[model samples]
Target chain A: MPASKIDLSPHNARAYLEPGPIVLISSRHGDETNIMTLGWHVVLEFSPSLVGCMISGGNHSFRLVRQSRECVINLPTVDMIDTVVRIGNSSGRSVDKFADNALTAEPALRVEAPLIGECYANFECRLFDDAMVDRYNFFIFEIVKAHRARRPKHPQTIHYTGDGDFMVAGKIVSRRGLFRPGMLGNGRS
Target chain B: MPASKIDLSPHNARAYLEPGPIVLISSRHGDETNIMTLGWHVVLEFSPSLVGCMISGGNHSFRLVRQSRECVINLPTVDMIDTVVRIGNSSGRSVDKFADNALTAEPALRVEAPLIGECYANFECRLFDDAMVDRYNFFIFEIVKAHRARRPKHPQTIHYTGDGDFMVAGKIVSRRGLFRPGMLGNGRS
Candidate 1:
């Protein structure tokens, strides 16, 4: 079934991204578009909705994102494990990823990049800083728009542990009672 | 039983950290020591065993880590959930975390920062780059040494979502056959 998504406040991006799941980064420049499996990313800030992605120079999508200065960060669930592995193993330079994988590429609200409709959540991001790009291939982006699946309050995301192994998102536990009033919803802790 | 740890090659740090569990960063400067609950971290590189941590300036451990230029990233298991919540709730400036929480601090081999004896894994890190510190509070650290428990190979680690919720690490799945030979253990994925 196609996932139903609802618009989310960009400020609340930390709720989805802080858990550190493996994400599929989709990029488009001119006539070229590509999707790459990415796990090296960090949430930098909550207000501007910043995230840092380290796209290695070797990946074909790296040049696409670097030139376009925009991309869509898509959260893929455990059901897409095989597809994720295929995307990570193949280079976009050689394959038409969307057509080959039979994944839907829907129009993003803010960025030029296309969002994967089958994914649980999609964050349209615009490049906020390129200073780290030259040295580390790290692009700090502002999540201009966010969309998440409405039904599954907590999606079963996959996290890479190298060597073709992935750890699936498990049970949810809340310590809200223990957290101070100030720290409960601030997104810092 | 106390964890019987075996030394791991720093290059293999990705196997433990790329999964993106909430880590406890322990740092020491002079006679003072501190530990902070960190969720914003990413495995940046494999060769130098580099990891980037976004340590917000507000945390008391920020000053200690910055001054010492060294820290131990400790991976806590699901069993330590309550301790993790308490540590994140309290400030290191006011509390001696090790003493107050009854978390034993063991001398590290390479860094002044002590390792959390109870953690599943400990990676001794040295600050590699601080250029992004002032602007983003992101510090790139090189893992100089690594250690992990022998038993419970797949530890149940916790990943934090906002509002005091956590997602525990779940089942492991491997797609080794799908990965190309080169991508199997290189750690880029």
Candidate 2:
């Protein structure tokens, strides 16, 4: 194809997953709490607990996250896509998403940011760079306290791709059939 | 759903995305050719153009890009995902991914890096932040040149959500249906 023809509209668009985990970001300035959808979060390092997320300046939660310097990354279920996309397309400046979606907010442990009760995983985070926020809309965070849902479900994580698209995680697929210790031939055994 | 019952295994499992956008990080090393898989990338800025991606600490491709502070971000299509994941999983240390993928490496006009012909969108990038990568495994690059696919298909972009699973971006829900202008009697509209 010529170098001038690729289109990025949402027609026949599919979500591309990077093979990582997903987390939602919840932030609050005062009594008002908001949740922004995300699948761009990644674990950059292990020691000292560092997490990275790229929030665009075009996003409303980006502003709140910048102001508070704190937010919660929550992992919602696939069933939450309708809500996720709705939040992504609409702005929190006008609509109260929690009130519109009937979602509840709970207090976080180490941060003032609120956590969405409907989410399965939550990460309370503190901001990393102040300059990058306005310049690149990308924020690196240090994870403070992590929380998991009270109940376990089978493959219940949700992955959000760009646009208004998402995917529900499938069953575990390992190198070996059912993952036997001797099955892996990498010489680790 | 008990917090104690939650297993962090899935969140920690390392997986590769087979079908996703192929980003070519083209760099030059001592008059030698260098190009590698760069799927951990995203648009970070709108005006003045910026992008971000992650490069392993020991990649030869990144070493050259760091030296010149210049590179190119090329976006491939679904047809090229197989090659994308292959290079991403394997290292450039053992094999030349461009030759393995049968891609043409041509020097960019604005940057010293080469551009991959297999990709649909190509962006010439200039280093934006070295601290983000040195500290957080995050590297930000600004786009100086961009090209579209030779053939434009439907508007579909791939996103890496996690695991080998991918979610195809579905239709664009109507913004008018969700919230019409002046529909909410409040002046906030």
Candidate 3:
């Protein structure tokens, strides 16, 4: 783990995930470890810090995640755009994603899945529900632990717009005054 | 209804929604109509154009959408950030969101819900599956029709990060050359 990274409350995962950046899902089963780029995900809840990820059935990581019932959601910044694309372009079945991409795999606090040290944030997740997995390939996971960089309050995240295009995170704008006091969950208002 | 808007294929809905922008969902039940701001949503599939939205049961629009089983997901650009926040802060039960926000309620082609004329795009959706709704407040909708502005290929969409703050959509980056031919669903590659 990087010294610059700090532990974060799992409940505050929404602050980093709600923006919908493309994330890398790292998983492990027995001796095998894999990483896959994923964008089809949503922040489902805050208290338990639940997130829903739609992993395609065809992805090699699917079997690993389904078998282990756990994975690490890694948030990569815009600086890792090329690496992100490359990770998404290749398959983890034949090549070891960590060694192939030259990404550092760091130990996570709560999950067996390793976290990508290059990512700005890493959320350790446990499968909370598998009810929708058979039908939609949607796995609802509860984020049990979170780690993020201490500096750069807002990192430039990359959002996939499909068809090989990406949208970078831009300027931050606040409407704290316009929000109802009860609606501001983070207490920043 | 605007001259600048054009009909789009339902499969192409990912081009507008995959980026994870905060969207305005318009719903109608009987004679009542309501609009609510939603950020918890994910693109579930492409061929059927499925989208999973976790609409909190407490929201006023929840009942309207649940009863009607239809909605118009309106994409509001960065220019409409204030309106988006205001819509999210207020309740549809007390205010006529369309009239109070000064947004035009244009009739949708496939759903009874009216589309926000000021939005960059509108996707008419019908509830595809309700199995997860009771357990997760998640509604799986299949986009039946889509409409978007012809110009300004990339709209500056706003993404919520809790605590009343928003991140606006920034520059457009493409890695067409790096993508596998089969992965480029839009045929641009």
Candidate 4:
């Protein structure tokens, strides 16, 4: 091993594992609705938009998602980092995250979970797989609806690098004529 | 909706869905082994370290992985951007990716798949889930072994923003005293 890249302790690798952007997820089961910050989530498929996230069984939203099988993934920008951390630190089991965060709930197109109006983009997803929920607390969701800030074109997203630190999206560089044909067009910058 | 943000088409959301870092995954079945580029992979858990990834049935590695059930997730630095895209654009069924790209394969500690020597960190993963393989072509992996470069401290990692553009990780920012005490400290910058 070189002096530059250190062998990360596998146990703590999640800190450097590119813990995708911290997003506020809204889950509703009947009358009980909850919002929580999620840092362990990622895109799984391009079409039908399958997404996977690890939601601990102890989380209040986990129960709501289990009963309802629906939730909205709200992508927050760098500006919302503080709010993201606050929501993450607290649990929805006791506190009403929506009221605590002073966030507005907007009706989504496809799911019962309302979208966080403050977020840069919102994805309404239907739980696609519950097979690994007990063993790993993982949920596979198929995004049934999607919405984003088209005006900003590209909002500065926050990526959690553990240690309360973040790396903001900056400097967009694209490779021309690299993508295989027949993949989506908008994927081309 | 605020003029600052817009709704994104659900079909093309992957472009902005926080497409983590593209990794070179090497898989072997019998004598046929292959390396493929993966942008649709993510961390599904922290403890047992479960990872979820989309491996299209069309790829040669998918078949190998189906039979072998093991592969290595190699994290490449920003310097390997060109090679990352090249490996992604091509397939392993027809050409030898290792010879074509001059990537060196090293022995792994816990898995049969060899590590990519040129990458910064390597995760030897064992296939953990096959339930969704036929339907969604998705696989769940357990990172049984982990290896990383000790030098370079923190190498600049790349995040694909769709198209040919890539985001080079820059300037670390930390949120002081945010993580749980027992979570792990070395993740601190």
Listed per candidate, the RMSD to the true structure in angstroms reads 2.4, 13.2, 1.6, 11.6
Docking class of 1: medium
Compose the digit string of candidate 1's lDDT tens values, residues B94-140.
99999999999998999999999999989999999999999999999
Model 1, residue A163: displacement in angstroms? 0.9
All candidates: DockQ: 0.69, 0.12, 0.74, 0.25
**Residue B110, candidate 4: alpha-carbon lDDT:** 77
User: On residues A1-189, what C-alpha lDDT tens digit does candidate 1 reach at each position?
Assistant: 124778888888888888989999999999999999999999999889999999999999999999999999999999999999999999998999999999999998888899999898899999999999988999999999988888578889999888888999999998889888888774422
Candidate 4 clash figure, as a count: 28
Cα lDDT computed for each candidate against the true fold: 0.91, 0.55, 0.91, 0.69
Q: Write the per-residue lDDT of candidate 3 for residues A41-103, one digit (tens) a residue.
A: 998888888999999999999999999999999999998999999999999988998998889
Candidate 2 Cα misplacement greater than 4 A, ranges:
A1-24, A37-43, A46-49, A54-68, A76-78, A85-95, A129-131, A145-189, B1-22, B150-189
Task: Sort all candidates by TM-score, best to worst.
Answer: 3, 1, 4, 2
Question: Which residue pairs show backbone clashes in model 1?
Answer: none
What are the models' TM-scores? 0.97, 0.66, 0.98, 0.84
The DockQ-based CAPRI class assigned to model 3 is medium
> After superposition, which runs of candidate 1 have C-alpha atoms over 4 Å from their true positions?
A1-3, A186-189, B1-3, B186-189
Between candidates 2 and 4, the TM-score winner: 4
Predicted candidate 2 versus true structure: per-residue lDDT over B66-87, tens digit per residue: 8888887766655665565566
TM-score of chain B of each: 0.96, 0.71, 0.96, 0.83
Candidate 2's TM-score reads 0.66
